[model samples]
Target: MTKPAPPGKAVREIVPGDSRWAELTHSDNHRFAIVPDRFVLPRKGHQVVAALQDAVDDRLEVSCRSGGHCGEDFIGAPRRNLVLDLCGLNRIAATDDGQRIRVEPGATVGEVQKALFRDWGTALPLGACSAVGMGGLVAGGGYGPLSRQLGLVADHLAAVEIAVVDEGRKVRAVTARADDDGELGELFWAHTGGGGGNFGIVTAYEFRSPAHLRSGGRILPKAAGGLNVQKIIYPWAMLDEATFATLVGRFFAWHEEHDRAGTPEASLFATFFLHHKSAQFLQLMVQSDADIDVGGAILAEFVAGLTEGTAVFGIPRGGLMTWLTGTRYMSQADCGDVMGARSASKSAYHRSAPTGDQLAVLYRHLTSDHPGQASYVMVNSYGGEINRRGSAATASPQRDSTAKSSWFTAWLDPAQDDLQIGWLRAAYEEFFAATGGVPVSGAATDGCYINYPDVDLKDARHNRSTATWHDLYYGANYERLRRAKRAWDPHDVFHHSLSIEL
Candidate 1:
């Protein structure tokens, strides 16, 4: 129902005072603080890029928004001279006899899942959060529960449609693919995992679908009686350093053992939440890949091993639920509400399991003396089919690394922003120090996940190390990404705080 801007007026000057304007630029977590000068929804890629170039000529900063789920300032900021909203371009084109899909930058993961499932009984390796935008997620190195079996989302990318600023022209929409075998191909490679909005504005992506499908046009096999999701909640008062260490260590060990066996049927995810009142609670969500009984048993045994002779306990349960159903995939209304809030977060990737001492350090930071801060620690199991693929298979550079876990700490307190931000950074630094500072360079750490875009890693503010922007995201692939950036965005028109510095 939206209309195009009037001629001769820049997109920024045509701002609407309606509720939709606020909804378009807001985020779900309510953490980011951004308000673009203007919101422009282009009907197609060509129009979007043309407007972006105009903003650049006018010396306006641009922030690209698709689903607007980025946890940080990557989108929705007044500093953004122009807000390029791609939601209008949401479309899915089927190809490769229904084994391939070309998705617009604005499509939500949930929409894609439903569309693919309804049409071809196909699904992409998508994240649990359905509201996440496809553009940012894949560009930031997408991961999900299916990641252990299939691989990261970037691994499936075949090609991308990008709008880069040229020296003479403002910006041009060009196709970048593995087959190009030219400078553009390298740029396409960077787009695969270099993080979105760094090299250029990605308008569409070409992806390969899974080789097979389940009945009812489902991508994954239906969980017997739906998914058997077991949730265990343990009050914080009952957890001490030893208990926490035992639980974390045992969980890591179980994942490593199962992953080595090749089946890795049980999917386990744990979240330790530290509330404002010094209260602590642990919630664990377990899903059996295919066999509920076997998966449940594995989790049961693992929990028992960790809590043996201890007072920690959990309730075992299960039910019928599709992969998307259990994850609380978002509706359009939910997406609107989430983008309108404010919050901040930090994340890290661990190449190895933390030792008992390291775990204790993390506990102290989370339970520190902050008045109105809530911190959450999520440990997800990595490695399985994800590791079987070679590092160079796609733009994702973390394959060669031994990292078994990824962690995120989020706090919601506008008044205590400084305190919360400092706490997260210090805690992360302590964690890295305890582990010999896991290299941000691809050579040592395989670089960090792009989805959790951290400007600190690239800026001198927190990361004083000599790691280049490419080194932080692409590893040895950084050089290739740089070549692509140079070729496509030779004018450096599409850029932001943490964009790849060429």
Candidate 2:
């Protein structure tokens, strides 16, 4: 592990041979990582501005990295870019009134959760993976198991402090808040779900709970009764074609029926992980904040809906644990572990369940021969309190979506890259053939999640849909985000392949 740089200051230098330099260049995804000429480690907000100014003065390209868990190569510049390493800015503190919390961009979700719960007995609806940095996650409309009841992490954002490049390419630190009257408020709106490394380098974020939500033991949602999680596994070998189809159909139908803002089942969240046929099993994990009495009932009802003709291998019950303990367990550490693997992913915000043909396509591809070593189709319940707000309320416009489907496949060796990537692409295209090879925003498909950040949407070959990249990602909110970008980052200092185009 790299030691923390000194506090209340920043460090900028070139370390082409340092072990940490090599490690920092690469992230959770090994598919991309172009080395930079220098690494700028900023310890504080002022230091972040100074580092940006230095990079601009040197005429070097710039990028920022917090947790380095991005699926794309936003931080992995392909040229002599100056990368701002923000890991040294980890800080979490609350306002004097205790109603708002200030979190530095480098603070991971785990750190934020622990601090919020320990200090105030409250929590934020952040990503399930603790390793995820607040910079990208919150900016990309983060959510976790608690999202169904609490809503997206971005919904809680009160203000954001960012260092942007001015017209002369000089660095300027600007604070945008939700309550700001003019352009500053719009700038803050863009950060709600504009995706990271786009508008500027964010140094810190302030999160505030709504007045109505101030009474709960936990700021976001009540976990006083404890949480119950259940994992049900069904071996694919035991599942006949009918059983498989029925299970998938039932899972989709359940969400369609109950995925409203407030409902009895709204607190119950479930995820279906459908691995390749060769993997021989599908897993459905469900969790709820309800206590043992109603928790068991909720889990039983959800399982019963999908077990019509299916034979399950086992249904393991997860023990009850306090909100803090359960959160600690849910924070995944595998995000940045290995870096040699190559993978391709595609995401969709489903407004409706998959059609019969779509389901058939998924089944055929899962069982087909493919070079990819591991592949899975994960469908997570979306909507609930997340949809309580309107599409234009934030930069993330997939509020009406009831479910999110993610198609992913991974493999080792550059030799298998084409095969694995091709396999995932084919699967996604076929699944949405009715939508012109992409999940176009409409009655059935409400576009894709920006957090997933699929560059494939930019290519005409992959996105045959009438809607373009901006349309699918931002919907009607694209123009607003564009304005924010032009105003704050006229020179387009912070950018990526799929960033908000000027």
Candidate 3:
């Protein structure tokens, strides 16, 4: 029999036939699901420690879930059936000095933002997805619209609390602070971009911007004013192959010039959503936290340049809104409940603009007559303050990349999985055909983002890149991460498919 949980903490057991079992096994990408031998939910850190101890005693493989947004099957292990649902541990609060904020793993990015703004009138540069949990996002080096101005969400980390098992097989909780010495310091650095669910199960994180320290507590960084957002759409019917390619080149050229470290234009952030030809239209969204007029002018200038020769379907307008309100506007698209649709995503990091040949391949795929599948390639502007830090400063080494691109597709039918999955993979493979079927760390591209995990990196059939998956994701920091993993999780209690190996 399994040991009982500590006092004041309850552990609910879920069997295969229970109604909750089906729901619990489901993940963000319904493409993969697993029926575990045991399932438990812990509401607090001590309970998590107790659960890990129990798992160790029984020699059971374990895994954890926060927001369940993993695009791959990392959260779903076939033999590892011991899963911990942390939703019950949701909590958010600010430190007494008003400089650092403490957030629980279960708390969504939306929840953390609201709490930070409400308690201290400050915010962190996190992903736009409202439902992404702090656990995976922060550990994977999160970035969003504000990242160009401030930096990665991981750059602001002050400390982290995690649960692990010791060599003697005893359950224990450890806190690793940025100011700590030796192993603790390494542990903290590993979480900066090493990716979550590797070293241990994270319980809480403390974050504070470096600019806050520079100000001597007078003012926070990049939050002095509100934000201005501009959303523009162009019907695909109006965009011929030449015009689409022209606009794409123009967009790339503009970002190459503006998204430099310490430049005034660095405050301007934009994302070009190029949907498949079947979607009927392409959308370009720009956001700036600067003065409304300055932001509007910048947006207007960029839009004007992109559509100089071609006729734009609808000339969009710029609107000014508070940070909270702007986030609400951005979050509107994903406001609904988490659907159980099968999903797949592939990501790439580019140091320069896409080559003419690459753009042509994209056009061919978008216009191809394939199954009516829903998919899109999102090109998000990267670099600015994010590039000021050197590769060795954090586990995230893609600091020099100018753009982060992701190919995402979703559907409800299992029968069409091959058609949709093949479409996504073919596009990615063709894009990096020059680099042996992957984005190798070089002048044109700098590997892929760890946050956008892709298991294909480990498969020889798909990953033809000369560099290994660790090199693509961690660059020179892979050894450091592996060492830290060996030190903290020698028992390999917390791990997944792409986890750091001892």
What tens-digit string does per-residue lDDT give for candidate 2 at 1-502?
A: 3444557444645467766677776777878865877777777788888878877898778888898878877776546577888988899997677656889989998888888877776777877778888888999988887787778888888889999887888788999988997889898999999889878889999888655545644344434456667777887777766677888888888888888876768877788988888777788877777543364577677778788644644556466667777666544456331345777788999888887888888888988886433688989988899999899988898888788887887676778778888888999988888888999987899888888888988898988888999999899999999888898889887778889989
Q: How do the predictions measure up, each by TM-score? A: 0.84, 0.94, 0.94
Misplaced by over 4 Å in model 3 are 1-7, 96-99, 212-224, 292-295, 313-318, 332-338
Write candidate 1's Cα lDDT for 311-430 as tens digits: 777554454356546444211234332234344555555455566667777778766785433455566667766676666666776764333344444444466667766766777667
Off by over 4 Å in 2: 1-14, 78-80, 216-223, 291-293, 335-339, 371-373
Kindly report which residue stretches of model 1 are placed more than 4 angstroms away from their true locations once superposed: 1-19, 28-33, 56-60, 76-78, 96-99, 210-226, 260-279, 291-295, 327-341, 400-413, 434-447, 458-461, 464-470
Number of clashing residue pairs in every model? 23, 0, 0
The CA lDDT of each predicted structure is: 0.63, 0.80, 0.81
Model 2: residue 34 alpha-carbon error in angstroms: 2.9
Give per-residue lDDT, candidate 3, residue 319.
Answer: 85
Q: Candidate 3, after superposition: displacement of residue 476 in Å? A: 1.1
Q: Give one digit per residue, the lDDT tens place, for model 3 in 1-502.
A: 3445557658666667766777887878888886678678778888888888888899888888898888888877745758888887788876677656778999988887777676667767778888888899989989987788778998888899999777788878999998888999999999999998898899888877786323546223535356777788888889888888888888888878876776667777888888888888788888876553464677668778988967765457558888788765655234332277887888888888888999999888887886533688888888888998999888898888888898887778899799888988999899899997889999989988887888888998998877899889999999999999988989887777788888
What number of backbone clashes does candidate 3 have, counting pairs of residues 3 or more apart or in separate chains? 0
